[model samples]
Target: MNEQEFLASYDPRAYPAVAVTVDVVALTIREGALHLLLIRRGEPPFAGHWALPGGFVRPDEDLITGARRELAEETGLGGERLHRIHLEQLGSYGDPDRDPRMRIVSVAHLAFAPDLPDAAAGSDADEAGWLPVTALPGRQLAFDHARVIDDGVERARSKLEYTPLATRFLAPEFTITELRAVYETVWGQPLHAGNFHRKVLSVPGFVESTGASTERGGARGGPRAKLYRAGDARLLHPALLRPAREEAVR
Candidate 1:
C-alpha cells in the first residue's frame, strides 16, 4: 500500500462528526379532526415508544430530501405527491442527552396535507400511523420528539392568521366554508360564518375563484357555494385574527 492510500484508511471514529437526522411532523385534517404522523420505535433506549417519523441523513442527501424519503418510508407515497407537499423546517432539536445512543441532531419539519392514510413503518421505523393530535399517546417519545411536536403545532396555529398555510390543509379547489373549517379546526375555536367570510375574501391572494360551483350543497339546507383555489400571495395582509377573550374582573 502506498503512503497516499494508507493515510486514507484512518478510523472514522477518531474524528467523529455529529450524526444528523430529519424528522417530520406530518399534520393532516382527518374526520374533521387534526392528526399527526408517528412511528413506534423498534430499537432500545426508547423501544416500543411512539415518536415522530424520522431517520438519519445519508451522506449525499439534502435535508428536504431526507424528510420526503422518511415520509415515503413511513407512508407509501412519493414524487410530485410528496414534492407538492408543503414542507418547512420547524426547528432543530439537539438537547445534549436527547438521543441515548450517540450525539445526534434532528431537523424537524412541518407538513400540511388535506388527508393521509395510516403510515406503516419502513426504512428505520418499526410502525407508523396517524394519531389525533388531541390524543397523543402517553408513551415516552424517542428523542426530544414531544417538544418538537409542540413547536410544530404552535407554528401551525400561529401561521394561520398571517400566512396562506391554512390553505395547504385543503384541496386545490375548496369553498370558503371549507377553508374556514380548516381555521376553526386548527385554532379549536368557533368563528362567526359572516365575519369569517368577509375577512377571508377581503384578504387579497388568500383565495381566488375558479368560476365554478359545487352542485351539492352542505349536508343540510345551504346554497351552492363557489369554488376557489390558492392565490399568488404567500402572506396575508390585514391578517384575519380571532377575537381575544376578556378576563373576568373581580
Candidate 2:
C-alpha cells in the first residue's frame, strides 16, 4: 500500500494511543522538617494553583526517565546524582476527565532527596519550594494532583515500615537516630528510641554497621552515635506498624 493510501485508511478510533504522563512527588527535608515540592501553575483550567511537578512523557523515554526529566527540567540539576534519587512508580491514575486537555494516563513516581536545588530552570513553575506536608495548601490543586500527592505520602509511609527506602532520605553512613527520624517524619509520630533501635537491628538486611561514628553527639546532649548503611535486603522480615489512634467515646 502507498503512503497516502495507508494514511487515508488509518483509523485512530480503532487504535488509539493513550497519552502517558509522568508526575513526581519529590520530597525533601528542610530545617528539620519533612516537605513536599509544589509548583505553581501558570496557565488556565486551574491557573495560579499549586500542583506536583510533572509533564507528559515523551515517546522515546521510559516512565522513570520521563520523571527524572521533569524533575531536572523543573529543578535545573542533572547527572547520575539525580539517578540516585530513589524513584519508584507509586500508582497509575486514569480517570476519564482527570485532565481537562485529553485522556492522560499518568504514572506517578515518589522520590526522596536530602535536599533540592533551586526553582525550575525556565518553566511555568512560578515558584517551587519544599512545603511542610502537614500543612499542604488549601487551594484546590490543578488536575487531580491532590489525590496524587496523598497516594505518594501513603506509599512513603508504608514503604518505610517494611522497605529500605528510608535510606534515600539520609546521607551515607548515617546513625540510627537519623534513620529513625526519617521514619518518624513520614509517619508523623514519635517512635520509642530504644525499641526502634532494637527492632531495626533485629530486621536482618535492614542495615549494616560501617564501624564508624558521628564526629559529634546529637545537637542536644547525647554521646556520639555509631553509623550504619542500608543493607542487601530490600525488605524487613518483621515490618514495623505504627500505633493506631484510639477511638473517642460517643
Candidate 3:
C-alpha cells in the first residue's frame, strides 16, 4: 500500500485507549522533618481524598512540563517560586486498574525544595499544604499515591548516599550542621556529626567553604558555625553511606 493510502486508512480508535499523567512527590524539610506536598481533591474519582499534585497531561505538553504545571496549579505557587526545586522522573506506574477510569499511566516525579511558604489550593484541589510524611500512615490517600510516596521517599534516601541533592532542600549557603540535619531528616537516622563533617570536607565537589560564619552562635552560646556552599561536583566520588549501610558492608 502507498504511504498516503496507509495514513488515510489509519484509525486511532482501533486500539484500546490510554492516557498519560504526571504526579509529583514533592519533598521538603520543614522543622527537621520531611514533608510531602498533598492536595485534597475537589472533584470526583476521589473527592475529598488527599493525593500528590498532578493531573492528566496536555496532548502537546512534555512530561516534566506537565509535572511542573500541575504542581504549580495545585500548590498555587508561581514558576519563579518553584524554580529552585529539583524535579526528576521517579518512575512510571501503569497497572491495568491503577486508575478507575481507563488505562492511565502516571509518570511520577520526585522534587526537592527548601522550606517554602504556605500554599493555597488550586481549582482542582479543595486544599493544599505540606504534610509530614511520618503523619501520613493514618490518613486515607487516593489511588496508588501511597506506594508512589514510598518510592519517592526511598529514592530521596538512596540519592543522598551518592549525590549532593540533599543540599537542594537548603538555602544557598548553610552550615554543615544544617546539611547533616537534611540527611538525618530524609534518611530518618542520626548521622555522626564529626564523621559527616569530615566526609563532606574530603569530597572534591560536595561543598566549598564560604569563609564566613553565622551571625549567631550555637544554642549553647559557642562560636558561630562556619558556612559553605554547594560545589561544582555533580556526583560525590566517595559517596556518603548511611551509618547502618556503611556498617553492613564492613
The candidate scoring highest on TM-score is 3
Better of 1 and 2 by TM-score: 1
Rank order (by TM-score, best first):
3, 1, 2
lDDT of 3 by residue, 1-250 (tens): 9999999999999999999999999998888899999988898888999999999999889999899898787656775777667989999999999889899999999999896667778888898999999999987899999999999999999999999998898999999999999999999988889988999999998999899999999999999999999999899889999888998988
lDDT per residue (tens digit) for residues 1-250 in model 2: 9999999998998965579999999888777778888888877767888888888888799999999998887777799888878888989999989988778899999988887776663466677766789788665688889899989988888888778888888887888988889888888888889988999999999899999888888789689899999899988888776655212211
Candidate 1, 27-63: lDDT as tens digits:
9999988989998888777888888888889999999
Off by over 4 Å in 3: 2-4
Q: List the residue pairs that clash in candidate 1.
A: none
RMSD of 2: 3.9
Which one is best on lDDT?
3
Error of 3 at 163 (Å): 0.2
Give the better candidate number (1 or 3) by lDDT. 3
lDDT of 1 at 228: 96
Q: Which ten residues in a row have the lowest lDDT in candidate 2?
A: 241-250
